[model samples]
Target chain A: MNVDLIDLGNESRNAGSFVSFLDQICARFELDHAAYAGTNPVASAVHGYVNYPDAWKHHYAENGLHRIDPTLLVASRSIAPVDWSRLDHTEGFEKTFRDARDFGITNRGLTIPVRGPYGDIGMLSVTRDCSVTEWEKLSRQILPDLQSVAVHVHDTVMRSDVLSRALRYPALSTREREILQWIAAGKSQQDVGDILGISHRTVEVHLRSGREKLYALTTPQAVGRAIMLGLIYPL
Target chain B: MIIIVDALNKDRFGDLLDEMFKLRARVFGDRLGWEVEITNGREIDQFDRLDPAYVIGLDDEGHVVSCVRALQTTGPHMLSDVFQVLLDGEPPLRSATLWESTRFCVDTQRLCRDGNTMKAVSMATCELMIGSLEYARRSGISDIITVIDPVVNRVLKRSDNAPYDYVGSTKQMGKVPAMAALLDCTEERINRVRAFAGITHDVFANEDTVRDLLDARQLAFAAQLGESSEWMAAILSGSEEALPPVLPEDIQDYCRAQIETAQTEEEHAAALRLVAVLVRERVHPAMHRLVFQS
Candidate 1:
């Protein structure tokens, strides 16, 4: 259960090294599978890394399981670590569980939700094949360690810039940022222009540009996008 | 701050979960008169037994202020189990990426004063909404089936988070007419709620923060004293006048009640020690500061 934080921290800066680290973690914990999926759900961007069987991955993708995977569905609303069996055995879940089992995904599993700053979200899941009684005992024994590991794994992946590459956000210019800041502070275009010693038309142009960059349809939407992107502060 | 508790982290949030269940009892069983199972001041049901994930909001003092429980749609949830009648016998929904959220409530009576409950309710509701969507979006859930009464639906719309669509006709479930409201877990919805609520900062607390908060609460509970008890009133309230020169016999009765409830001898001694310290601290207030500071 002991993780060499120094090694994990140093190796996480590189994508390959991080994947190897995840593999080592899986081995250390006797896990059959380990996965880290960092996604920008807003942009529909996903960057996933896992030591799961390649066939299973292909099957998951080919079937579009990402759209209806109950584990991930529950992971979305969860901040704590989750057990796969804890999910309700409702309608479509049997197929998912069956498919995963067919691909050697064990019945005993845990997924931890990780939230990064500014709309970055990810989950770290570990799966193993064991009886329910054993799974319960082992989970209790390693819960704290697993929690720590999940955070470190998330931190490593975030440091590697994999998600940033997949989910690229447009940066705002200094002028655009300032205008958006004023708008967020409740300044009208005319008021912003007057306060900044610019013309109202110039203010409008900058705001419009900012809005376009943020993919926003209106001023408030632009402000929201900017705030979410850390481009501007809210008043 | 909001804490997401699932099977892995539920152990850490045991006290908070109990608090949330009690709050649910008050809101659903007492206030709304839902025919829910209430035992020992908690409203719990089979869904809770299913190990559903809960997004809980805590105040500065670590009290449960608002909460919502999420169950995977592939399994038994209120919309499919207890309230299937609302669907009018339609085939139950089974999806991997959709979740069911229920037991949404806020501590309105606790948060409000002077008949000004609207603002408190609005703030808590908006915060919970933001927390839920943010969590949902990250977890890869695309849609949420929320089984809500008409009054709760109105609250959502008034808070600027109208459901994207309704799946079933409204039908009586328990005492209120309920329906299945489908909400998309998208950035646009989160933005709309944020703008409506005027909330700009992240509502989530980190694991370390949650651990610390829960640990402090556990210690407070172990002493059989609420964290905001009169024993520490002067120090916490920042008003020396809150404590009298000598302990009142009634206050001593309160301390005695807690001490007498201690299950173990060590716990009894610890509680007694705490009572002695509080009494001594009130008479020599500077001693309390010196002891803690050193």
Candidate 2:
């Protein structure tokens, strides 16, 4: 394999440029598709650009497949790139793979996990529809370069203004933070309200607002997010 | 003494690896302020997950004083991934016989804490150099492409273990400028570092002896911490509430070793206090699952 050094220094910075970059990578490496997903540390939300079909994207989100997507769940936790073949064909995998095959997406893929300084994780997943032997050869040949590309994509996305803003901690009021901290320390809503010299209903209102700001569904989830973002300390 | 920790034997040296990560956190995260992830007072990154070999130096009390990470160049490495800017427009070096050495650091505060001069640092540095080169030579590795700062580059020259060649120009990385230097894994280079450090005997620690010593220390620490063998067995057998969910088994093992080998009463108390702080903070969410699963 004639591997040439890839230069990303001159790549244009724009909203659609990431898609173009992924398209270029797919073309150069003879891949069917390339996708990049980065988790925003502050909100714990995932956002990225992918070259897969929009129909598949909508299907994936609508079905909440990310919750069980081995490429994301298993790959994000690992320090190394995960080969799709190495993942077990569990019930979730079968569902995802069966659905993906209908969209002409093969199971032969690799997901390279990139960890940033502040505990953020970025995954670059690429797929190729080819014979098993061909995929093995191609993956082996491109693994090193793909790893570097994964980091480049991650760093670029992390530096973007949108991501930077998302990375910023949600601004929580002092009272709200105190309430959450107390709640995390096993205080009840009434106890927090009493400690803060407020009504229980007012405490509930503050918890609701904090939960909204953190994009959490429950008070405990909001408290967890607050603790993770360093907005509140755990007792 | 120098010890090589790789994937095969990493389980046996979990405590040493943890200390090495903490040392890296101090050097790269705290002192240098590099864009590196630090969790639970340890600096660990994606590359560390790839099972890279670590050449570490431990003091008499088994404190990890100096360390460097070596990764196979054929796989993804710092030079190709994080520090590609230093490569200019050139292709990243990839070869089975060439390893990329990076994250080279020494615990300066610990080594020089007693008002020791540069002697301790230099000795440790030379010992590491000798250790990595000899290990590489034995493993059939031909050359090492290291990403080093200018200060380390100068030290390499001063110790007469300088690189034979350079690749790509230097670029400012984090708080310091870094360049890639290539060093051959040869007897001549090893001899130069050994001669410079005046280390004639083997620098590698005897694995069996080290394990025995550490095991003995762990027992002593358990006794001093008021934890009996029965308590340890209970914890090991999954006694609820005895061990905190946030404390991973490996970290608990490491703390046990630290308490056992502590030189002073204050040191032993400090180790115990650290465990308290960790349990209180519950700093790492990932460690929670590890504890529960273990």
Candidate 3:
């Protein structure tokens, strides 16, 4: 099913239309259920919508199923469309799966993981009750559409914090920030090593980790990004 | 195809573990002259019992062509236990999110030809790497500390997914010198390997499929060479079942020619054993040259 793309710039208006958009998605796909869950690990905020039986979402939140839900676990780590059946059936999961089934969440479904620009993880799962064979056929028909729609839904409906979060920039250690600051102030790697009382190779390691944290392409870029992020100040 | 195996699904790995251990012996004990303990033609150690995750790359014929092992850094790891000499007394780095990747090797005979480059080797190596990064990223690991030799280091750089930095100074580990190298477990790293390999799709197969494909190949080989001949019976016995992967056509022809040229029963048996191993583990095209020369 298709819904008109809402203007994300109008935050309040977009927020209000999100439920209708989700409803349209379920209606078009003939899906019995749908959900869009977002987790900003940096901010420790988990919020989502699941059009399941009443209070099920609240119960799931109260129980903190987000930490152990196999489907969400896979969605967080992979940029893939995880078939619900492919998840691990570990301790405590059988009950979760059975309880979900009790709520009309079938054994067969698909969850498309969306990694946001600021490193937030979210997923859009559409579920229906059907035999494995029928589910496979339906999946083949709708997978491409579902993947595109998942990304669209995540971008449009999910709250994004691009400027502040920068997609969860890896938190740099104090020493790492200091070394990067020195590098930004025209110090060579060897110079930093001498100043820090560590080996030059150790300095290189910190610098490399700094670059990786900032997702920088080189030493210069890493230093520049560090300064821009206020992780370090220039001389 | 690449397969991911951990303690949970390792039971479905079939003959791959045996093949990997034998290959390790060949590379470490025979070729590199490492001081590893090899018994019954297999190089296994205490680490194998630790239930480390394995990323195995198999050729189209179901032969394992490349393999690497990963262990949680928070637990006892090879670098922490045995390779302490390399660490220089620094406490082994441990974290819930950091992993140790070790035992990285490619079947040079099968993949590389002129001891330089081959399409299969490059593809297998890159695929194995992609598999490792994907596995790590999904498991919430943020970094990988691998005790890699210089040759592997160069290969990683060549493949465009080099380690971000080295952790310790180089030290001699058996015949080859090695260093602790660090690679960030990130999608960007995975993308680099994927782009270099020109792969755009997932390369992983479920554990059962891997077991079935390998079992079917071995059963077919058993059917082709029934346990009638004494030599075949001896080599194919359960105690000595470390036979190589199914042989290619040219190598089969070469083995037949060598068998015909045998002058005695003992010579024939020796030639048969050598031929069986050679066909299964031919890492390079020039291996025949070394065999003929010797």
Candidate 4:
């Protein structure tokens, strides 16, 4: 399992031979199914290759089954390796459990979750048609590697934008950004004062302070610079 | 080096925590008018001890700045009681692997706001978050969930316009005119309207209303629907009932993705990458991504 985990990370970061490398790991781990789920938190765009039937994905997306997908419940919050057995079974879940079984996802599974700055989350799941004993064996054997691979990949995914922006723009404190954003929104000193509950003069001071820090000539220029640098976007 | 001092265990951190609290009061309380007693001028909370914390900003000598506290989940916390309401009947996340990054107070006296040093502080905070994610990465921690005020929530919720890395449920609890925002909505637009942050009065008019943000609120799902329908859908939209991705995993990916794509005239991207590397080196492993870097 540990070797398998190493292989997975090596494959994901290779940037070449990606698919085959991943497929080999998937097969070595005896995983009946695997997926790389990328979520857009803003759009609620949860896209991944679940071993579930295509019908299920379609239904989940079209009919919004994600709204009721209890598996996601734990996936959304848990920060560790989770065994499907630990899930809180929905009443009558076993009655229709065959739906998941047909898709090879019901046998037994483990989920390795990862999170980054600003609360982004991702998961690496391995499922197989093994008995509880076998599943437990697999989970224990690979949990470390699962965590490692998930973490590394998740880290890489988040830093993908570095080539675009400069190096020094995101260093301001929360309060500074809070004040700058208010001013950038076309708010007058008095208006900014009202929003943040500070004196208009204080708003003036913050704006001036930001202007001096950014080395901009005017208030509007400072606002433009902040926006360009992703410093103070609209709230 | 960032330190996480406990606001509740004031005696432990002593002067630093006291000074931190006073700064908070001056910046948030006196500024925002939450109206708490500010004997020395600082706003403290119970949850300060319940999560792994850090005052990871900067000092004035043009040097890197930070403070680490002892407000970890294994310790005391304000949310266990005051914010337990948000969890309701469900077993929402509250664990060690999943730390709630708390209490970001900078020593303004130590920080130099000249030459984009403010950018340095912001990047440092982002770095701390990224580091926390890395720490969680090695462990079994699956998420990094925390309660945010309306202002922070609104900024992140304007997902349609602003690029914030978060996904969760937003419920309107309590009752009419007093409903709580559960953060379950993905449409980054139309986030819950918040009261004034720096305020003693409600002089802030209702500028951006429910109507303006509804579409942004439902942004995640808007692509699949019609334009007008997307806007109309979010306001009346029901819950995803689906769980949000674990906070740590979600954030890590989001921040990395953002770092990869961020563009700016200043050095925001370098700061972002540097911070990302530092976060991966220091903080817990996580899934949250921060796109706020330029």
Top candidate on TM-score is: 3
For all candidates in order, the CA lDDT equals 0.71, 0.74, 0.68, 0.43
Q: Write the per-residue lDDT of candidate 2 for residues A1-235, one digit (tens) a residue.
A: 1334233323456548888888888987889999999975655666678999998989888999888888877666544456787564556677777799888788889887766545567889999999999988888667655665676566556655565645533556565678889999999999997898766645654565465345444567678778888888878
Q: Can you tell me the DockQ of model 3?
A: 0.03
lDDT of 3 by residue, B213-233 (tens): 887887765664443244344
True contacts kept of each: 0.03, 0.00, 0.00, 0.03
Pairs in steric clash, model 3: A1-A28, A118-A167, B108-B283, B109-B282, B109-B283, B109-B284, B110-B282, B110-B283
Cα lDDT of model 3 by residue, A128-173, tens digit:
8999899878776666456546655564443445543344444676
Deviating ranges (above 4 Å) for candidate 1: A1-235, B113-117, B217-294
Question: How do the candidates rank by DockQ, highest first?
Answer: 3, 1, 4, 2
lDDT of 2 by residue, B12-46 (tens): 89988987888898899888877788987789998
Query: How many Å off is the CA of B47 in candidate 1?
Result: 0.7
Output the lDDT of residue B135, model 4: 40
lDDT for residue B88 in candidate 2, whole number 0-100 = 79
2 against 4, candidate with superior DockQ? 4
- Over 4 Å off, model 2: A1-235, B227-268, B271-294
Kindly list the per-residue Cα lDDT of model 4 for residues B54-162, writing each as its tens digit: 4433232212244323222322333334444544432223223334443333433335445556555443444333333444433443334445455544433432222
